[model samples]
Target chain A: LAKTTQPISMDSYEGQEVNITCSHNNIATNDYITWYQQFPSQGPRFIIQGYKTKVTNEVASLFIPADRKSSTLSLPRVSLSDTAVYYCLVGIMDSSYKLIFGSGTRLLVRP
Target chain B: EPEVTQTPSHQVTQMGQEVILRCVPISNHLYFYWYRQILGQKVEFLVSFYNNEISEKSEIFDDQFSVERPDGSNFTLKIRSTKLEDSAMYFCASSEEDISGELFFGEGSRLTVL
Candidate 1:
């Protein structure tokens, strides 16, 4: 299991692009990077995932450099509704060893 | 979009009482997991089940906690004897093979032990 480090919180206005970075210096060769979003009173939701380089979807983009020591999650356009905690996880198959979570970055999308 | 579902959105139990939390994961998912989050704290993994057996568990998953896939679709977490410290939001999640580590979690069952 690779531990990740991210900012405690970030504030952004609606309609702006927000990029949050997570550092995992000990990322393993087989580990995949994934991001999750959690809203108050609800369970965490899958946001996006990637292995290397960059991957994009309708909601966000993930950019991983060659070092694989850090990755960034980019939310194209922010909205008040997007305010939530974002978690970055690094693991491979059978992550059951432990799916530990840390104090994720609380992203506040101000309207 | 299929999703995992949990029953008894909230449960209140007396100390030493037995309690069961229920979950119905996505139909096609093969792996099941249970996690808990105390108030204002990070989520902690409890256990993971597959092939009708526990594949992994955390230290917090003591003897008092057990998971069972009693039927084809229902996965449950049973607490033998509840303690006040057991009060927390319990979440159930599932994923397809390779997991993607992308667990689809349910709304969660808030348990309050008094």
Candidate 2:
């Protein structure tokens, strides 16, 4: 399991793009970067995942540099409802038993 | 989209009492997991189940905790003796494969021990 570091909190305006970066300097070669969003009192929901480079989905995009020491989660045109705690996890895909969630970045999408 | 479902959205129990939290995973999913979050704290992994048995468990999953898949669709977590420290929101989740993809999680079962 790779330990991750992220901002404790961030403020973003509605309709603006938000990017949360996570650092996993000790990330292993088999590790994949995964981001999950959790709303108040709700379980963490998967937002995006990528092994390397960039991967885009309907909800968000993940960008991993070649070094793989860090990754970024980009949310486009954010709304107030997008405010939530975002968790970045690094673990082996299909082999790891459980996801180790660290204190995540809390994004506040303000109007 | 298929989702995981948990029963008794909230539970209140006394110390030393046993409680069982139930979950119904997505119909086609093969992997199940249990996680808990103490109020104002980070989410912690308790255990993961696959092929009708436990694949991994955390240190938090002590002797007091156990997991079972009694039938085809239901996965359950049992706490033999509750403590005040056991109070937290218990979340059940399932994945189509292993960690290769996203996990579908239930709302959660909030357990309060007195």
Candidate 3:
């Protein structure tokens, strides 16, 4: 499993866009980048995943540069309710048995 | 939007007692997993189950820990004898058979061991 690093915490005002980046310099060839959001006392929900380049969903967008060593999760017009801890994981999709989670980025969307 | 579901949102147990956590994964999901998070700590994987047996397990899953898919719809984790140190939030997750590793997590079960 590749290790990931992200900001410990961040603050954003309501209605503003937020971008959180993750670095995984040793990401493996079969690794797929995935992001998850977890509200207090709730489960971590899958936000987006990508192999390379970019991937977008109804909730968020993921941008990966050619290096594939890093990626960013972009949330548009975030609201106070969007405040949550965000986790970035890199592993083989549908192929790996192990998934390691780091301390995650605590995003505070202040109103 | 089928989601994974876990029962007993909260559990308070005494040390040396047995406890079982239950989960009902998405109907179509084929791989199941268990993870635990102590207060203010990172999430840790305990075990993964596939094809009627364990696919992988972390060191944290010890001899006292066991997992079973007793029925088609229910997955369970049983701790033979709980310890105070076992206090933590336990989460269950599942994914499609293809192994894309995009696991969908259930709202954890908070286990409070005293």
- Among incorrect, acceptable, medium and high, the docking class of model 3 is medium
- lDDT of candidate 1 at residue A59, scale 0 to 100: 98
lDDT of 1 at B27: 97
Clashes of each: 0, 0, 6
Q: Which stretches of candidate 3 lie over 4 Å from their true place?
A: A92-97
Estimate candidate 3's alpha-carbon lDDT, on a 0 to 1 scale.
0.87
Q: State every prediction's TM-score relative to the real structure.
A: 0.91, 0.92, 0.91
Q: List runs of model 2 lying over 4 Å from the truth.
A: A26-28, A92-97
Tens digits of per-residue lDDT for model 3, B1-114: 899999899999999999999999999889999999888776778999998899888879999999999999999999999999999999999999434659999999999999
What lDDT does candidate 1 reach at residue A76?
Answer: 90
In candidate 1, what are the lDDT values of residues A2-54, reduced to their tens digit? 46688999999999999999888766666678889999889999899998999
* Kept native contacts, fraction for each prediction: 0.67, 0.52, 0.67
Superposed by TM-score, candidate 3 places the C-alpha of residue A103 at a distance from the truth, in angstroms, of 2.1
What is candidate 1's local distance difference test score? 0.87
TM-score of chain A of each: 0.88, 0.88, 0.88
